[model samples]
Target chain A: GDSVTQTEGLVTLTEGLPVMLNCTYQTIYSNPFLFWYVQHLNESPRLLLKSFTDNKRTEHQGFHATLHKSSSSFHLQKSSAQLSDSALYYCAENAYKVIFGKGTHLHVLP
Target chain B: NAGVIQTPRHKVTGKGQEATLWCEPISGHSAVFWYRQTIVQGLEFLTYFRNQAPIDDSGMPKERFSAQMPNQSHSTLKIQSTQPQDSAVYLCASSLDGDSNERLFFGHGTKLSVL
Candidate 1:
C-alpha cells in the first residue's frame, strides 16, 4: 500500500522567519503526483500546491514545494512565515489512489 | 459556482443505526471523492466515482459501507450498523477528472457522531 509520512506533527515559527514542513512518501508507481493541502480552522481543506514532475517547484499563495523523487520527498517551504499561514498542513501522494500524511499543525507568532 | 455542497453539516446516530451522508459536486465535474477525517487517523480516502461510475472503492470497509452516484450532480455514502469507530467527519470532493494533478473542490464536510 502507498503511504505518506509527515515528520513534523507541530511547527512554530516567529513571523518573518522561514518555515518548512517535511513530507516523504513510498509508492511503486512511476509519475507519482504530490500535493499540499491547507486546512484553516472550521474550513475545508484546500489545495495549496501539486507536483507531478520531479524536481519541479510548485508555488501557491507564497508557499512552494519541490518534488524530489530521488529522495521520495516533497517538502513545503516558505521564505517568511506569515501570521495567516498558521493552519493544518497535509501532504499527499496520488497514484491510482491518494494517500495523505497525518498532517502538521503550523503556528506563526507575531 | 457554489463549490461542493454536503448536506446535514452534522449528524448524530445511535450505535448500530444507519447513517447516510450526501454530497453535491461542482457542476460539470467528472470525478467525485469521499474521505473520512479524524483526530487520530487524519484523512482517509474511502471511495471515488468517475463520470458517475465507481472507479475505486478499495479504501471502503466491507459489510457496513456503501456509496452510490445515481447522477452526475450528487453522491451518497451510507453506513449500516454504525459504530463508535465510524464517528468522524466525512468529506466529499469533486475534480475535473481522475487525473492525478486535477484540483479537488471540497465540501465543508459532515461531522458524524455515533453513540
Candidate 2:
C-alpha cells in the first residue's frame, strides 16, 4: 500500500527564522508525484508546490521542496518564515489516488 | 469557472441514520474525488470517479460508504447507518484530468456531524 508521513505534528517558529517540514513516502509505483498543500483557517486547501521529477526542486510562494527518489522524501523548506506562513501543511503522494500525511500545523510567531 | 460545488454546507444526522453529500464538479473536469477531513485524521481519501465511472474506491470503508457519479455533472456520497466517528468535513475536488501533476480544485466542503 502507498502512504505518506509527516513527522512533525506541529512546528512553531519565530518570524524571520527558517522553516522545514519533513515529508516521506513509500510506494510501489515507479513514477510517483509528490505535492505540498497549505490550508489556512476557514479556507480550502491549496497547492503550494508539487514535483514529479526526482531530485528536482519545485517551489511556490516562498516555499520549496525537492523530490528525492533515493531517500523517498520531499521535504518542504523556506529560508525565512513570515507570520503569514502559519497554516496547516500536508504532504501527499499522488498515484491513481492521492495519499495524504497527517499534516503539520505551522505556527509562525511574530 | 465556479470551481467545485458542494451542496448543504453542513449536515447533521443521528446515529443509525443515513446521510448524503452532494458534489458538483467543475464543468469539463473529468475526475471527481471525495475526501474526509478531521482533526485527528487530517485528510483521507474516500473515493474517486473518472468520466462518470468508478475508478478507485479502495479507501472507502467496506460497508456503510458508497459513492456514485450518475452523470458527468454531479456525484454523491452516501453513508448508511452514520455513526459518531463518521463526523468530519467532507470535501469534493476535481481536476482537469486524473493526471498526477494537475492541480485539484476543491469545494468549500460539507461539514457532517453525527450524534
Candidate 3:
C-alpha cells in the first residue's frame, strides 16, 4: 500500500522567518501527483499547490512546493512566514487514488 | 455558491446502529470523493464516483461501508453496524473530472461519533 509521511507534527516560526513542513512519500505508481492543502480552523481543506512534473515548483498564496521523485519528497516551503499562515497543512499524493499524510500544525507567532 | 454541502454537521450513533451521511457536490463537477479522517489514520480515501458512476471503491471497507451516487447532484455514504472505530470526521470532496491532478473542493466534514 502507498503511504505519505509528514515528519513535522507541529511547526512554530516567528513572523518573517522561513517556513518548511517536511513531506515524504512511498508509492509504487510511476506518475504520481503531489499536493499541499491548507485547512483553517473550522473550515474545509483547500488546495494550496500541486505538482505533476518532477522538479517543477508549484506555488500558490505565498506557498510553494517542489516534487522531487528521486528523493520521494514534496516539501512545502515559504520564504517569509505570516501571522495568517498559521493553519493545518496536509501533504498528499495522488495515484489512481489520493493518500494523505498526517497533517502538520503550523503556528506563525507574531 | 456553497462550495460543497454536507448535511448534519455532526452525528451520534450507538454501536451496531446505522449511520448515513449525505453530500451535495459543487454544480457542474463530475467527480466526488469520500474520505475518513482520524487521529490515527490521518486521512484515508474511502471511495470516489465519476459522473454518478462509481469509478473505484477499492478503498472502502466492504463489510460495513457502502456508498451510492443515485444522481449527479448528491451522494450518500452509509455505515451499517457502526463501531467505535468508525468515529471520525467524514469528508466529501468534488473535482471537475477524474483527472488525478484536478484540484478538489472539499466540504466542511460531518463529524461522526459512535458510542
**DockQ, structure candidate 3:** 0.81
lDDT of 2 by residue, A1-110 (tens): 99999966789999999999999999999889999999999888988989999889888989999999999999999999999999999999997688899899999999
Supply candidate 1's per-residue lDDT for B110.
99
Those runs of model 3 whose alpha carbons end farther than 4 Å from true positions after fitting are none
Candidate DockQ values, in order, are 0.82, 0.79, 0.81
Q: Which portions of model 2 miss their true places by more than 4 Å? A: none
Tell me which residue pairs clash in candidate 3.
Answer: none
Which residue pairs of candidate 2 clash?
A: none
Instruction: By TM-score, rank the candidates, best first.
Output: 2, 1, 3
Give the best candidate by lDDT: 1
* Cα error, candidate 1, residue B45 (Å): 0.7
Model 2 per-residue lDDT at A7: 63
> Which model scores highest in DockQ?
1
- Point out the higher-scoring one by lDDT: 2 or 3: 2
Clashing pairs in 1: none
